[model samples]
Target: MAPLKTLLLVVVVLLPVANACQPPRTLHVPVFHRDALFPPPPSAKRGSLLRQRLAADAARYASLVDATGRLHSPVFSGIPFESGEYFALVGVGTPSTKAMLVIDTGSDLVWLQCSPCRHCYAQKGQVFDPRRSSTYRRVPCSSPQCRALRFPGCDSGGSGGGCRYMVAYGDGSSSTGDLATDKLAFANYTYINNVTLGCGRDNEGLFDSAAGLLGVGRGKISISTQVAPAYGNVFEYCLGDRTSRSTHSSYLVFGRTPELTSTAFTALLSNPRRPSLYYVDMAGFSVGGERVTGFSNASLALDPATGRGGVVVDSGTAISRFARDAYAALRDAFDARAHAAGMRKLAGEYSVFDACYDLRGRPAASAPPIVLHFAGGADMALPPENYFLPMDGGRRRASSYRCLGFEAADDGLSVIGNVQQQGFRVVFDVEKERIGFAPNGCTS
Candidate 1:
């Protein structure tokens, strides 16, 4: 991957602001609740605490700020994976071993493909062995959670308890295995031990880069919910990129806030309509100082049965996608800006920005300014460099193309990926009904 060019310049001026009014009577955010499938086993709480201490020490050694002045939180990068996906390494079994897994907030379970096969692509860390873990147990297939996993054509009549099942991703990736317990380590902090996770006997199209996923959702059994009982119901991560300055110290704040100086941005409590999940009130979206009217209200709803929300905040996604009209408006604005720069719009595989030019031509002397306006009157101005990706078609020429793409998903919801989220402090408050954003120094 080419070095990420800093393209957006943000100047955050601290402002004194009053907190939004709190609604009377705390709202009961309906979350999918499940009884522990397996009995709680004895754990070394002191050992867990000791692990946390080691994590703090590790963080001190890894923490560093880049020249741009933005704090580079510790992160583990360069784990191998296919393009356009997210993955992480995780520990499983009596003695924790590492496995590469997808880090999916859209998912509720942190599972791994496990077996005796030596050819299984694995990260350079410990491997999870379910047979050796005494606490490992499975939920019955008849259980509600397992039944939910059953697809439209999948047969529910299975002998396995809720502990064993299979799951398929939209990208055609699938993992089949028994649900079992294992230890999980985050930033050296052993937050949960003998936690329920997938022990897969087989997986197809699984990325070998990540050990396992860290499911950060609101489901009762998800990493967010399981650790909430211990960590104060929150986890934070800064996406990794070539420009990232920190190392394997990337953080996962479980049951506690990652240490940072509080800014003037008011951390609104999440709306109670969504339970066990982070839903932020998105006031609206803007571009170039003008508000795009008729966007969907930021209020989100969580489906307690599935432990998923109607709308979610995902940083791993590379662009900020909106519902139909919002997406069209943003695209149209960008197209207009590109046309103004004298580029002729073209339609082709390498064509982007609704405009294109032959690589042999002189590049435009100037590009128009592209800015995004957010709720609470914050404006993020992005330069042309931020929106374009450098492409080398078969010809020996260099051409810059916009990195924007819009599509309506089968799930009928919009996604804001890393492209739009670049250089912003995204706060996900599960307790509050709103997502908050502030500008960061991401541009040169």
Candidate 2:
């Protein structure tokens, strides 16, 4: 057989690019719920998918808290891959081989499962082979990209070889490989060349069937930061209804879009300890137009000294989480309104949700409106579907139950998950350091 490197050098022609006056001002990529990775079997239980997701959510919350505890450590650790709920199709390399990558706003490194498995987990598609791409190049140890990694390593052969990366998650899942760069392309025909990435050769985890992760966090090496210059450090995303199998396609957009405009804007908080995570000021919450009392600014404020307490807007976690006390207050207020509205509370189990209601005979109006009160005047009015997630996976039968999607976090940091973010265009303006919420923004 020919030498591996020489054999992969076969010339292949590619189509000419359309008249490029620079890539589009914004690029749109379709995103989907993790359940879309594969079709369920005929005998699969209707609620099994959601039940498993909620179990993963619990583990995800635990991992998030553990990751925060090691904030000052040199290791780059984060939530488990099995905890990821949404994914987007991404293209990489010269010819742009497509792969399904978890769209994560929580981490900093962008990596994918590569060819030559050294203990690779089973994935839906063929692993990405860097040798097939003409533009593929290994990042050297001396390069700044390698230095940016929190857990960067040098090739065992010495400093002359490619830089190495080892990312270990809280659940013991890890990806170790050489740091490299290639063309990162989108479906819109726009592409960014020489984008740094990890070509994982030794990988293991409960990543499901997805190829890898696409980090869009605020770290220097994150895709959002690396592509910030061209896109003006602005991007927006709107998650579709995850409970519906026939829902419209969700989107992850880079750069400004007409739908990103929102009347309500909140100042982005910063925690020097964990700068990669998006922080927000959550003043309080309301159920059925009545403001839930007992939650003060300190209840959700970021601790300047410890950098521990605060709220985060994350895309990977399945359910929104809040501080225990704060959650109890919110739950009580919701229960009061639910009782007054004639909605019957169920003693049955539904994931971590303590407030489950059987709305079979109750009118739609009986379900109270839940609103998030931010520091600014922005009042995010969540639709019934956003907060009252259907207990059944995709079944909307009259016998089904809807549960409050919020849960109590084990730690101080509260996370607003994708479930609550559905149907709203969430704009992350890194340049201005503000986050915007536009209602009914998932038109596409």
Candidate 3:
């Protein structure tokens, strides 16, 4: 017979081994609206807020256009973006420096303003200081990690050579500094140690008070890639409806998700040049179940040699953008439908959106539902609210403006904007190279 003392010793010895082999806990970061930014902005009127966001969107898209170009040309090492609607709170470093950074699906590098900044932007929360972090380490140019970067140039060469990167956006914003490895912790307290990221020193941009950006793009150097093993290379976010006044809890969850029955899927196309962006084989689009012809060129094709066509799922940009011909066709169709339904067309262009309707005397512009028919039969249907913005934002005529939330791209590219992504759970399955769309996807 085994004694009680012998049993206790065996159990104690096995416990440590079991814990070591166990996977880290799943990270759940609550993604809230940018309006909750710390230090806050000067309270502006609703109209002013809308205009500000629109202007920021233009700047961000311009940067994205330039980023894709830079990727093919190999002229730049880093790209910086200015604005985003959702910001995630992540704790980085050994002691942990909580940073409020914009969540961007377009760019690949997770960067933040660091200390000893010769130049810096006005950031709200505490600026992350690498020196304060016990686990901080810089990736040298000669190392494999440094070589993996899109733009890797070593200011200090060797095994310990510091990998320095310089990224300039099309909008005149830039971030330049060292590529480093640090402990990246999420709100869950669990963390991935020695995660690679950009520690920005000299930087200039219109980023309002937020520390930096959290890059969740499709690239080897992206934050998502670095943390892949911990979560099986998967991440999904459920964006709340921005039109709602009462803020509900929305979130970004790491690791695998249950196969949602209502979810639709489309394969992610291959793009060697600008692989960071999520490219889907978008077959066509339809308004009121009627397909608009002659705008086929507007749908960007997934071709490596061309590097021109194809669309990306961008969470950074607010409105959707399609190639010129496609945008024109879409606008014409929407306007025709709205006019037929008794929506008074406003004169001239309202910002970047062309289909501005006077919803003063009319009920909310109930344009027919638009559906995005992706490759492999995944149809993503968007309500009228996804493509149109109510100036007043309520039934009781609060403001006299309503504009289409879609835009025309300078290049023949298409972007599924956040507005169109509202009230749905958009899943980026990087491992399988496919995207999933579930109706009314929400996360806490």
Candidate 4:
């Protein structure tokens, strides 16, 4: 017994020394959600075609609630249209709803033209009423968040405190109302309760069918920032395209993910132009497995006057647009590959690439990979889907054609939209200067 006791004492003493000699363990961050965070699947009967379309639209509007819990980029229809901008909707509050509301980012409030409006649009969902909800509380005008909205000069003079304000968009869309809180439910595991939002009146634009604009951009009062202080400052979202309605979804991850660090794609810090915004380093664009040149050393240009870098990674735009030189090189390479495939040149100077043909009616598997080269000699290989879609332009309207086009932009930056950024897990880290891309697909 005495010998055993002495041996245990020696083991305990050596344990601390052994731990001290070992290197510190690195902290692991998670990339994807292991469990659903929002409400369980709704048992309501399948919605009508209209209802299905609205739900589909909502999924397409990808948003990121930040560390502050403010929402950014309320995507609509998979297109990243400006928020706080006003648009008309057919239905708003009624079963056959139609109404107009301003889409905003800087403001969390989402309200519609209601009660006694001469030309009000209809809405599909129940209108939010502060008086009806016991949890509703108007924000005081004196709050810093309210003051930020004062800049665009759209404030409509209300009792200001907590989370409320009238806001406008760059396109002259405006809304007036008291700011309040509400619940935001995403199809994924994201349930944001007590989220600051706008409740407005007298909205315009009566053709839009959406319930209202979701304020998901980076702003002081946006959904992500406002909720972060209370609910761990993290939000996630998934966006789906029109074609893959049921199975397709994309996510917007706030803060950091433990699973991303191990990805093969290198992560680079975003440029510090918009302090709140994040961007990923685009490596390069490729055609048919061949690496296109000239974009290797591309540096995002910062507009000193605007304090924002024009380069953007958008999942909304349908095509990849670039400056003149970059566009010419990419277009030419694709045309060359098409000509080699025995495709006749069209009157519009379009060449068909044989590589675009496959027994499956898709690009052949043997076709070269369309690679995008990055600054560090890194490359992102895009699948055929990234470049070709059902061709719609020219006299060949209904006829199927596969080709690429480039549009010149005044801004000296390249845009990598959803059409091009497919097949990779793009992680946007706003706090850090890095955007990480992993060679994985949402399907995988």
TM-score of each: 0.62, 0.89, 0.86, 0.62
Per-residue lDDT over 12-113 for candidate 4, one digit per residue giving the tens place of the 0 to 100 score = 121101011121122111221111111113442222222332332222222221222222333332212211122222222112233333222223334443
The residue pairs found clashing in candidate 2 are none
Report the number of clashing residue pairs per model: 49, 0, 6, 87
Candidate 3 — number of clashing residue pairs? 6
Off by over 4 Å in 2: 1-21, 67-84, 246-248, 259-263, 363-365, 392-398
lDDT of 2 by residue, 58-84 (tens): 655665666434321111113222333
Q: Write the per-residue lDDT of candidate 1 for residues 1-444, one digit (tens) a residue.
A: 000000001101111111112221111111100001111124423223323322322221121111121211112222221223333544455555655454444446667666653334544355566677664556565444444333312225554434465655432345667765555543333324546566666665434444455556555556555544333444444333322333332223333343333311333323233322333324444444566555455322224444332333553343343445555656666556666655555566442123344423535335445555444554445544444444444344444433344322223234444444444444444554334444452211
Candidate 4, superposed: residue stretches over 4 Å from native: 1-124, 150-176, 185-193, 227-238, 247-276, 294-300, 303-310, 349-368, 376-378, 393-399
lDDT of 3: 0.68
CA RMSD of each candidate after superposition: 15.7, 7.5, 9.6, 14.8
Winner by TM-score:
2
- Residue 84 Cα positional deviation in candidate 1, in Å, after optimal superposition: 3.3
Q: In model 3, which regions exceed 4 Å deviation?
A: 1-25, 38-43, 71-84, 156-160, 243-248, 392-400
**Alpha-carbon error at 363 in model 2, in Å?**
4.5
lDDT, model 1: 0.40
